[model samples]
Target: MSDCNKTDFTNPSTFILLGIPGLEAAHVWISIPFCTMYAIAVLGNFTILFIVKMELSLHGPMYYFLCMLAVTDLVLSTSTVPKTLSIFWFNSREIDFSACLTQMYFIHCFLVMESGIFVAMALDRYVAICHPLRHSTILTNSVVAKIGLAVVLRGIMLVLPYPFLARQWPYYRTYIIPHTYCEHIAVVKLACADTRVSSYYGLFMVFCVRGLDMIFIAVSYIQILRAIFSLPTKDARLKTLGTCSSHLCAILAFYIPVIFSSLTHRFGHNVPLHFHVLIANVYLLVPPMLHPIIYGVRTKQIRDRLLRLFTHKGM
Candidate 1:
């Protein structure tokens, strides 16, 4: 077994993030759309957090989970966009090796954290839908805290090794990453060492966190559906389904693009490099931007409160 720590790194000083290889001429034009989307994502997720804080009535398991989601969205987007935008807008692409690794660590950590929170939110929805009477007891403050801690720890445990692993691998060639962000795969691909171990470990972590959680979430909803149909009244069914609409949309918003983007990148040989990078960027950007909008539209409390908040300022 070759140890990466003992290996030498060629050009160990800095890495160049080449923003969209062939489309370098259009970077300024591209920054417009990217910057707009980033602004909306930051503002939208921030508003969700602020509203949750202001509305004391929202101090429940459902909203508490949403708060966690919002915070994760904020951090997740923050991990990549500013640096990405800097590259696009200013051409300031040189990053110190350690800083690059640090950025990569946070990006992977926050991404896993975001996915874990969705699973937590799913369980919250399941409890609220399937066992309404016991929901409060089951998802108590203590329980929520425990779940939140677990989600954070899961991210920490899984992602901590990624940067360390990448750092140990010696880079003898170009330190230029073609994409906007410092992803584990992108960075490791530049290493002179064989990446089989790091690659497999990353794949395993993805399966454990996102894949397993997705499976559990599916089962939870299946059980929730069974419980919902067993309700005696039509209003009860509609009311319960209404409560789940926002969460269901959130699930779709978070997963659908990721699945599509992942599939295309892994399997689509004919796909253009720029197109894949763009799709990948969208996968990260769209969720946080849509989180508040989806919840605000589907949730009457958030919608009405936001309306009141704006209307008050006008008066």
Candidate 2:
């Protein structure tokens, strides 16, 4: 496979995603549930976006980050969910080579953006709690806009090499992805050419983006916790922590499975295929579903606003 020239485009024009093995035989049964989950994920994230946008009171740094998160979830889910559902529904799991790279690029791009948003949320909480006097001044509109621009530019820079490396790889006649989505590692592994460079680059970007973001979040929360402890009143301490509880929960839910999945893929190759699939799906789906619930339940303002919106709509 490596012997084939990169210029030789005469090989496989379309790649097939093997999809879920057992259910591949029963496409109809699989399609219904997958499609339903996709719809719910999209609608739920869109609702979060709408709530944040419509409620002017939710325009603070916290909600601004939340809205950005909602958008990321929508884009992330959109990139893979529809394609997965289509595979099950129509038994049409074929994706073009260029299309696969595009999907992989967007998936990775949003992933980095999501991490950036999490870091920004942590900083917002830190300012609000630790430096209350300068919260507004520190997280001003101009500053937030700059942060957003930085996040987008950084995300693009981080993932740009992936598609380029992928395009350079020689494709064998066989191009079948085992997973539902166009995962970066999964696609890279299929490259007939030596993928050492691509793999190393991917790992480097993943670590730099997620690793640094996690460290920043950890340090921010440490400062926040220190400030909380310095508070004279227990209620003040609890209140300050409570304000970030939702974001903390979201960060945990989003990153833990992802980190675990990546580790399992790298070090636990002997593990069962089903175990990898289950964890990977959880990493993708669980956060999108849990995010709105975490924010809505943890933040009374969001919950009340949602209730009022539904109540008025009911009338």
Candidate 3:
């Protein structure tokens, strides 16, 4: 082995990120859509936050949870997209070792927090639909604040170990990450040491965060469905189910991509590298882009308020 190869840059001062293994030539073109999606995510999520904060009528647990989801989406997408854009636009791919870990931490941190927010939103829907009379009392401001704090803390605590564990491994193999960002598995895969622990912990974190949250969301929806079906009139059932459409769409948009990306990363060994990278990028970008659109279009209150706000400004 060459002396350079033998040298243990236990932790390389910096790592090089290959935008997309085989698609570097098309990076400029690919960035267009990614940039657009990110723009929408930023604009739409901020709009949700602003509207929710200003609209007295939207002062409720449901809107509060929407605000949480919006913020999480913003952080989650922001964690990766700007760097990816720089790589595409300026060929800037060198990320500092600590910065890589910071990116990984925020990416996973807000991701888990987003999942928790989804669960909280699911419960909010369950209460509003299943126990209409007690919705306000059950999800009062105090309880909502507590849930938000718990969600934030849970994300911080659960993902806190990712960086610590990854830091232990010596990246002696190669510093060239063949993807846009410092994805935990991607970064750790370069480490010369045995990675079974980090890999296993990552899987455990996924199950504990996404899997368990999914199960809870599923159960909440089940009860919600039962409550909807129990209603005496078809119209009543439809109206109640309608109330959940936005949340359902948001959940599907968020989790389906996440599951697919995680599975492909761990198990889809046969999948092409570019395809995997593309899917991963899409998973991060799509939810944030679609979330506000879903809620704005499906939630009548938001849609109407938005229309009125725009119309008033136009006039």
Q: Considering lDDT, where higher is better, how would the candidates rank from best to worst?
A: 3, 1, 2
Model 1 residue 181 distance off true place after TM-score fit, in angstroms: 0.9
Error of 1 at 11 (Å): 6.7
Model 2 TM: 0.93
What TM value does model 3 have?
0.97
Give a tens-digit lDDT track for model 2, residues 1-315. 545663567435778987775556876676675567667778878888888889989888888888888888878878887788777776678999889889999988988888999999999999999899999999998898888888888888888998888887677666888888778888887777778998788777668779999999999999999999999999988987888899999999999998898888777989877577657766777787778888888998899999999999999
Output the number of the lDDT-best candidate: 3
lDDT of each: 0.84, 0.83, 0.92
Query: Which sequence of candidate numbers ranks them by TM-score, best first?
Result: 3, 1, 2
The clash numbers for all candidates, in the given order, read: 0, 0, 0
Candidate with more favorable, higher lDDT: 1 or 3? 3
Candidate 1: tens digits of C-alpha lDDT, residues 152-257: 9988888998987887767854679988888677787788778899878877766666788789889989998898899999999999889888888888888887
Off by over 4 Å in 3: 1-5
- Residue 145 C-alpha lDDT in model 3: 100
| Model number with the top TM-score | 3
Worst 10 residues of 1 by lDDT: 1-10
